[model samples]
Target: MTDERTYWFDTMQRIASPVLHSLANETLHSDLPTETPPLKPSALLEAFGRTICGLGPWLGATDIPENEKAVQAEFLDLYYRGLANGMRPESQDYMPIVGDHQPLVDMAFLADGILRGGDRMIDDMPEDVQDDFLYALQLTAQIKPYESNWVLFSVLVEIMRWKLDDPAYSQQKIDTLLQKMMQWYRGDGIYGDGQNVHVDYYNSYVIHPLLVDAVTYYSDAYTRSIRDVVYQRAARYAATLERVISPEGTFPVLGRSITYRFGAFHALAQAAWQHNLPENVAPSQVRAALTAVIQRTITATDMFDANGWLNIGFYGNQPTMGEGYINHGSVYLCNTVFLPLGLPVSDPFWADPAKDWTAKAIYGNAPVPRDEPVNY
Candidate 1:
């Protein structure tokens, strides 16, 4: 494997092993550190679901190297066992999917994982486990999401339902939520978190990724135009994400969920994974940029605890960086940076020669293309 790919896979295993291993062994509740007891239940779901979301594409790919595939097989076993344990009421690590508002968010991440993982996430599981998994996901219908980005969460869950042919899936709900999202579009590849604009990474963190994935799955005459516009905006926003990465791999760190680290590039990573990057953004440049960010962020001294669970911080263990809603499990969203790992090693994204990203080129006085805003 190339160094960047190796580093990404190794780091992913490092971040995910503890959560999946403990849950698979039914020891997650006891093993995971819950500095904030009230958030513990939701936090557990956050870790598992978000980890799967980031790992889904990689998990589903069939053309990976043999060594990587072996490791993937191991993790797949743990994922199935973890799912069984997390949904079983009798198990100590059982995660509640039907309570409070937070599960609405994480369940969407779980659903996104299933969607990205494709058939591998469901088709390979035991029938009983599959039944339990779908049942747990269906329970999210009881929790009403807020009108903001949370709307996309519900949309994603429904999309997953549609993909699985679950009877509970509602096309009406998906269409309705998607229409609401269109109203929030503030032009220039940006969407207000809801009705109002907020300067944050939620666009990358939640809105764009969810909308793009949702419309991609449920495409029809009703969604065809929406898909065209969403993908156009997504490509534009992805270009913006690429430009923001500094030569040192640091970004502006503007936003509420700053503690999610490299997840700020979810749109960029997803673009590469889907081969949807704008014509101006070379896949090799994106690979270099992302590899730099991953190194800078994960190398922080206290990014993880003694036991390997991620700590809350933009840089290190800066608890002050966390919002009231942030918790240990929440930081696992950083795994989204690994989305391109879903592509095969032979794909140009992995095999191409490295090149400087926009920022790096500008900082080094190298000739670069003119920057322009997307008029869409």
Candidate 2:
């Protein structure tokens, strides 16, 4: 039987391959079944964007067992083929940049996926393919995101532009997005998505992750200081997330995007992957906590369709949990929970023996230190 961590990465591949295979081969438009969708092409691309982002770190890793190398080798081939098809204006796989709305907003995630895998995927593309990929990504500029965390969408695309050495990249836009995130900071390790704080997971799912990633592209003293604050807050929030997991592996199915399931823990998983956990939160416990969550959520009945496509639901097919904006692809955001799987097996996060997470430590016989308030 595969261990939970291996299962997590495999699950990521299983969910991604069907969409990517057809897209790469130019059959996605014809072969993909458009179900429960408000928009077909956009939803399919969403599935691609969300899936590839999680695979980014894993695909970039140089160390993995032989089996993972095989899986990586296969998918990397599919990704390259699909990438070329997606970029060509005349190709059947050409993805439409419909409007300056959600279509382009989703493109930010596509940009993010490329950024994450750039060291591995983008760098290896043949010269012409590389130019095609960069041009396709830069085309996301046509859309204008809303005032909230959506601003990060545009920023992500622009940052990728800067990364590709796109001559038209704007430094002013990057600085503006950074300032906007600072304004949205609500203190106590949380951020209001945009103008108002909706009770949801977008902060962990998108905002801070992109914030930390963006600063690295153009590092300066001011950006470095802001990045530090972002890491500290994200660390604090990650600790809070660990306690939310129940001993039985269940959690409150709260707020919007409950269908996103364990993706709510993206920040916690990312913090652990980055080794940014607060001092009190041991890496072992986080691994344990996330493993339990991954097992519980992925095992949920009806999570995948008969053909292995991801359905929009939390546990089973609880479609009501999804918002009007959610389509089948939106749920793929759950892949972010597997971020820690990108770490090499020898890292303490994976190598350390299993330990009781915060909940289990406090409730069970394990000794845990007293909790301290995080002061920012």
Candidate 3:
């Protein structure tokens, strides 16, 4: 495997192992560290759900090297057991799917994991665990999401139900939520988060990735046009993300949720993973750029506690960087950078020779194409 791929896989395992191991053993509640004791319950769900959301594609892929596949198989076992334990009321690690507004967000992450995990992860589920999974999703169905990007949460949950062929899935609700999201699109490949644009990474963190997945999954005659438009916008946003990465791989620490670390590039990673990168951006450049960001961010001192749980910080254990809504589990969203790991070793994303990203080329005085804004 290439060094970049190896780095990504090793990093993913490092971040995920502690959570999955503890949960699978039904000890997550006791093991997970939380900045706020009262928020531990929500944070546990955040860690598990968000980890799987990012790992899903890699976990589902069947074309990996034998060594990697063996490792993935081990994680798959832990993942299945973790799911069973997390959903079972009798299990010590049971993470409530129904509750306050927080579960609405993490449940969507869990649902996105299921979508990305695809049939390999879903089809092998134990019958009892499958029932519990469906039931837990049904519970989350009642959650009323916020007027903003939270709308996409509801859409993803419904999409998961649709993927499972559950009768509870509502096409009407999915269509309505999706339509609401489109209305919030502020143009130039950015969405307004709701009715107003926020100067944050929510576009990459939540809006574009989930929106693209929703439309792609629910594709039909009605959604075909919508899918094209959404992906076009996503590609544009992705290109912008690529350009912003500095020669050192650091991006502007802009807006809220900065503590999610490298997850700020979810759209760009997803574009490369899905072979949807804009015409001007090369897959190899994205690989190099993201690898640099991962190295810079994850290798920082104090990024993780003594026990391997991620601390609430952007660079290190800088608690001041966290918003009131941020917690230990919330930062696990950084795993989204591993999305491209879903690609097979032979895919251009992994196979192509590494190249300097746009920023690096410009900074080095290497000839590169002029940057332009997407007119759409």
User: What is the Cα-based lDDT of residue 279 in candidate 2?
Assistant: 87
At residue 373, candidate 1 shows an lDDT of 77
Which ranking of candidates, highest lDDT first?
A: 3, 1, 2
Total backbone clashes of model 1? Answer: 0
- Please provide, for model 3 over 146-211, each residue's C-alpha lDDT reduced to its tens digit, 9 standing for 90 to 100: 999999999888888787779878888888888899998777898998899999999999999998
Clashing pairs in 2: 24-82, 148-194
- Listed in order, each prediction's TM-score against the native is 0.97, 0.93, 0.97
Q: For each candidate in the order shown, give its overall lDDT on alpha carbons.
A: 0.88, 0.77, 0.88
Candidate 3 overall Cα lDDT vs. reference?
Answer: 0.88
Q: Which of candidates 2 and 3 reaches a greater TM-score?
A: 3
Evaluate residue 198 in candidate 1 and report its C-alpha lDDT on the 0 to 100 scale.
Answer: 89
- Tens digit per residue, CA lDDT, model 1, 284-360: 99999999999998778898899888888999899898998888889999989999999998998999999999999
